[model samples]
Target: MRELRILVATAEAERLRGVLVMAAAQVALGGQATVFLQLDAVGLLRPPIEAPRDGAHQAAGLPSLAMVIDEALGSGVAILACQSGLALCGMSAEDLPAGVEVGGPIGFLQQTDDDARLLFA
Candidate 1:
């Protein structure tokens, strides 16, 4: 399967939403997709808030952040939060949502070792 990997470095709602939409689209097309959240992007891996919590910042016509994440995961997208990011944000692995992996250097290397297309979001 084709693999598409995205490196997320921001926590801005719109930016996060955009990248996730892209990743989820790839998954829907029968391709493998991954999102590696680093730095501020790790914020996306935090526990889900109530419905529409992030809907305000969502792009027009795109799914809510939570919905997009769920769809992507169901479609075999690997969502990862960087270990350094978690520490930097003072969050533990327990703070992350289910199905999200706490990744380190080695894990990052392995995930991108494939001929995956990389996008920085």
Candidate 2:
């Protein structure tokens, strides 16, 4: 199976929606996709709220984002929240969504393995 890895660093809500949409697309195409939500991107996993910035759409308003995240999780997308991000935000493992894995260096290493496709957004 093809492995797809994505690194997202944006905290803006619109980008998060796009990221989720793309991830879902890859999963739908039958490729194994992993999303590493780092930096401020981990904010995407927070309870749905207003857009993080002006002119940005809320991920909650766009059902595709949550749906894709759920789909990716069910299909083994390996969604990860950066450890530093959690600490920086004063969040813990319990703050994340069900099935979302918490990791930092080690998880990132896995994505760099051969046969994996990587994308940074």
Residue 77, candidate 2: alpha-carbon lDDT:
65
Cα lDDT tens digits for candidate 1, 1-121: 6688888888776676678788878888888788888877786666753334465645556567777777777777788898998988889999987788888756776768647887887
What's the C-alpha lDDT at position 66 in model 2?
61
Scored by CA lDDT, what does every candidate get?
Answer: 0.76, 0.72
Lowest-sum lDDT 10-residue window in model 1: 49-58
- Residue-level lDDT of model 2, residues 19-114, one tens digit each, is 667776777788777778896778777765335342333433545456556766776667889988888777778888889888885768665788
Off by over 4 Å in 2: 48-64
What C-alpha lDDT does candidate 2 achieve relative to the native structure? 0.72
TM-score against truth, every candidate: 0.81, 0.77
Note the residue pairs that clash in candidate 2: none
